[model samples]
Target chain A: MLKAFASYMTYEFIGLDQGSRIGDVLNFFIYDTIKIFLLLTVIIHAVSIIRSYFPPEKTRKILAHKREFIGNILAALLGVVTPFCSCSAVPLFIGFVEAGVPLGVTFSFLISSPMVNEVAVVLLWGLFGWKIAAIYMVTGLLVAVLAGFVIGKLKLEKWVEEYVYQIKTGQGQQVLTQTFRQRLQYARWNTADILKRIWLYVVLAIGLGGFIHGYVPQDFLVRYAGNGNPFAVPMAVALGVPLYSNAAGVIPIVYALMEKGLNTGTVLAFMMAVTALSLPEMIILRKVLKIPLLIVFAGIMTVTITAVGYLFNAIL
Target chain B: MEIKVLGPGCANCHTMEQLAKTAVAALGIEARVEKISDIQEIMKYTMSTPGLVVNGKLKHAGKPLPSIEKVKAMIKEEA
Candidate 1:
């Protein structure tokens, strides 16, 4: 449908030759921009409404006093519905510990919340196919669960800041109940707000994709980072870690790289590293977690994500 | 009464601040609504941004932000 509109705009409206490179690039850009923006708006609004049901306070209550494996899984899944900001890490950490939620379970929520975000899922589905998107989500959850579980077993609670355990959060405020109308209003506001923040990144990503589609040689990236290269996954993850960007911001670059023939697994790992293991999140987490614990968390994430990348490369 | 909305100035923090202000006005109450963006100040009150502090007490923190009516009620309780 969008392609037809793009063709009409280029050929019938502007009278450009259908076979021209510029026309093809223009058509691709227009179609992608419209489709992605539409997808983002509808999906983000729906997710926000669902999110209104799973506030951090409620999530903490659900995970509080839960067992190991079950808690990890629940926390990982809830991380998707829960609203997360790195800025809230300290409060969230302190709140969870004070509420008697297991440290590992809280870590699961923290890891998955940023990694398996709605924007990342929707963008992957829109740009790639459903299969790749599903794989990314499942793998992201696995990473969170396994990493959190391992950290739990290590008994790293002692490494947390002393004040976190010492502080008492006296029956923290109750979750705000919302009517359907209010939920709709909040969702609308949230969708508009998110779109405003990410619109530029979307345009830039599609524009870059269009450029790659028009001019970049198909074999350029394949020659360097294709399936045969053993180090490609780790290299991608290493490069992705220091660069701080949300999924939306990185999708354009991912699109460009994939079009240039980078393997799917390498690109996926890169996206995970960028969103999940960002330096800023680490700096924020450092305030609550001692140095040794912080290093272990980063180390475990790096190893787990790298393994996921390699697994995908081997299978797909 | 003194009211503080704590956050790092993210969108939700701004919304919470606006809701607090509107609630204060709707109740015809004399109160100052302040936004605390500094991380240290926010930590002292609560770890959550978009926290609501009324007269030195932490009233609400974190998501599922309250409606204007709820905010008003919280203020009423404090007052």
Candidate 2:
């Protein structure tokens, strides 16, 4: 139905020439926009309902004092369903510390939450397919886990700000309880909230993708950032670091880049780097962690993301 | 009565603070709605920012902030 509507609008209503590149691009954009928004509405609402059940307080209780590897893994998983905002990073970090959750485990949660989100997943699935979405998610989680484990082994607790250890989260955390109706209400608002924030990015992504599909010549970027270039992955990560956008904002750019003949691994790495590591988040984290730890975090993420890009480039 | 808004001074935190004040004034209640900007102080209430504390009891915390009506209800409950 979506496909038919997209084609009708492109070919009949707009009267773009049939079988032309512009028609194809328009169809792709229209079909993808509708499919992605619908998927996001359903998935984000469901995720919000799940999130209402597992607030940060409950996640803290579940993760505190667990073994290292297992804790890191659990923390990364919880990061996905837990609704965390960058603004709350300081308190949440301290809360984790106060709960006896290891610094590394906390890092895992912090890394995965922002990078692997429902909007990104929905967009990837709608545009690329499930396999690519699955790859993005699994690699994202793996990167978080591996980086957290490495941070754990480094024993960088001393690098944390002195005050983080001293501050005690209140024991009387009021458990936020709501009725099913309230949860549904929250979900409705949550979906609208997410859509409002990312609508521009989605539109821009699809628009840019359409432009690329219609105008940019095939293999345009292949020579420079293609699989043949050994430095492509690192270069992509380097370019991605300072640039900041949410996953939704970045994926369309990824699609455009991939379409222009950027190899899969290099494009994926660029997306990960853009979403996973950003200067603003680092600045926010600076309140809890010292400069050195932040540096180490950035370094490890860059390396891991680059490696993943290369791995996928070679295997897939 | 005391109402405290806890956050590290983000946009949401400010909105929460403003909501508490409006809720207080609309209720015609003589209450102080304090904005707690200090992270240490904020943590003593809840891990999530934009936290609402009614008489030092955490009423709500985190994003997707409660509506103005809900904020009024919380204050009324404390009142």
C-alpha lDDT of candidate 2 relative to the true structure: 0.89
Q: What clash pairs does model 1 have?
A: A91-B47, B6-B50
Using Cα atoms, each model's DockQ against the true complex is 0.28, 0.69
lDDT of 1 at B15: 96
TM-score of chain A of 2: 0.97
Clashes of each: 2, 0
Write the residue-wise lDDT of candidate 1 on A1-65 in tens digits.
78899899988898889899999988888888899889989999999999988887788889999
Candidate with maximal TM-score:
2
What are the models' TM-scores? Answer: 0.89, 0.96
Classify candidate 1 by CAPRI docking class: acceptable
lDDT of 2 by residue, A198-260 (tens): 988888888888888789888888877776789999999999998998998887789888779
| Native contact share for candidate 1 | 0.23
Candidate 1 positional error at A80, Å: 0.7
**Which residue pairs in model 2 clash with each other?**
none
